[model samples]
Target: MHRPAVHRRDPRLEIITEAVERLIPRATPAHLTVTVTETLPGTANPDGTPHKHTWTGKPEGLAVKVFTALFGRPRTEEQRSPLAQAEDAKRARDLVGELDALLAGGVALETAPWYPCRPGDLVHVHHRAVGDVPLTPAFGETYIVGDAGDGLMSMQLLAHTLPDTVEHAADMVGCFAAEAADCPVYEVWFEAGAHLLTVVRDGRPVHVGGAR
Candidate 1:
């Protein structure tokens, strides 16, 4: 029997990278060095795009120990339960497996920064938390609103003390209407439980309303 081809690139790595990036600033100690390693002879990505893998710097079967060493053990007993611990261990093992597979495929691993958003660039928001209104952006004198699941009309005004600030529906109609208004503003919207905001000309997001 012939064996099917194995996928070289894993999409879960992206999620891990994003999560690690977000948590590193807060969770990791400043003194510790974080590195990503990849196996040699990289392979092609599923989407036909170039891809890289992050190395955990730990040998196979030791990922859980490495993860615990870096992040520390769970604080509460509830989180340290057998099932919870198993989940964490599984995550570590999966990460290691993915990295090993990528390296075997000749995928080059390199260090990279996690950039959630950049100015003047279109970004896709992926919100993990649920709320009525997740993201809001302000331009010049107007506001761009994004509603996650709640109705547009029920959206709340973000805390801002600027003049001529108005809330536009999260939909295209509202976004375009705001853009058409005399007041200049960046377009903002939410999708897939995340907030998507258009960056302004300046190298900064117009404004992220509500506590990030």
Candidate 2:
């Protein structure tokens, strides 16, 4: 059985969340965009507010000033308008569709945060939480696509297979292991695409349905 998850707050991320919570005027769009700085870039008043808080030489908006007080000053930051970000995501989804065949060929894990699910190999997974309460499906399943040995596996996601994502999704919170199998070797669907997800049973590959 999977153990319940534990969560802790990150002080740095909290700086932004708290500023938004305390200072954001109610009715602010859920998608409001603002540029902020960790650096106040000016003298501080006795109470600590910067004497000359500004952005790129111009005075900062209220949101920027609030964040500036929390973070020293950012070296670089960018906030695209929500609509623009949405458009980018839409285009990206289309692009992923176009490259389905290529993506199906293989997968790799990001170096620093590689998640391991080898029986008895323990690892910590970062995921969303509400005041120490982890979100359900906190660790979404990984549907492993193939083996890369030395504990690295090319995985995907679904309940019974490897796990839930073809790749790491922004909100994936859990890892999955099969109950029992004889080389699953099956087709699996990912966001707007499909690919083969194969599993080895007792050191052997199970090829099926035109898949190797």
Candidate 3:
């Protein structure tokens, strides 16, 4: 007997790249990739599209482990047991004043000096899109730092910033912008409950997100 084929949903790597770009226009290719675990399986065809596998892994300990790693927290057995069974029924209709404050900020996972990602650099990003707001790609701006007598030092303007100053033309001192302007965005397709983002740079995945 012959088996039938199954279709899989497209991945979400492209969306994250676009979101980074929207925030920092000069952002260059960083990396992007996705990996699915026991929940689903697939094989690639000659043309390269993945064909979905119908069999699914049962969710229990393995599923809990995957979720904990992705969200930076391990699920407590007690929290997963009777608490889930109770369903928080008492708080069903209490939706007012739940949040204390909604502060706007960016989270940085890496710290390094300025680096060059020239004009022709291509990058992939993965991010979540909600409602109608477009996601921003990850990136940084390029600029000159100082002259080393023979050549000028290349620099990348970091992506995080707070505020700034204003002055007259006579006191026009050029300052590096604390944030990066995004550009050339793309979307990444991901499955529900997947925790890690794999970034394929130059063919092989170099960095993994949702870990740090």
TM-score of each: 0.19, 0.21, 0.19
For residue 23, model 1's alpha carbon misses the true position, in angstroms, by 5.7
Kindly give the stretch of ten consecutive residues in candidate 1 with the minimal lDDT sum.
186-195
**Top lDDT model:** 2
Error of 2 at 67 (Å): 20
Clashes of each: 8, 26, 40
Write model 3 residue lDDT over 1-212, tens digit each, in one string: 11112110111221222333234433333322223434323667679766654433222223334544654333222211112222333255322221210000000111101112223222232233324532232322223222223322322222221113222322322233212232111111111111223333344333333322
> What residue runs in model 1 are displaced by over 4 Å at the alpha carbon?
1-14, 22-25, 28-33, 36-155, 160-212
- Greater TM-score among 1 and 2 belongs to 2
lDDT for 84 in candidate 1 is: 32
Residue 25's lDDT in candidate 2? 46
Candidate 1 per-residue lDDT, tens place, 109-173, comes to: 12212222222232322223234453443222223323333222112223233223334423312
20-73, model 2: which lDDT tens digit per residue? Answer: 433444322233345456555667889997765434321123434545587644
Q: Model 1 Cα displacement at 51 (Å)?
A: 29
**Model 2 worst lDDT run, 10 consecutive residues:** 1-10
> Which lDDT values do the candidates have, in the order given?
0.30, 0.31, 0.26
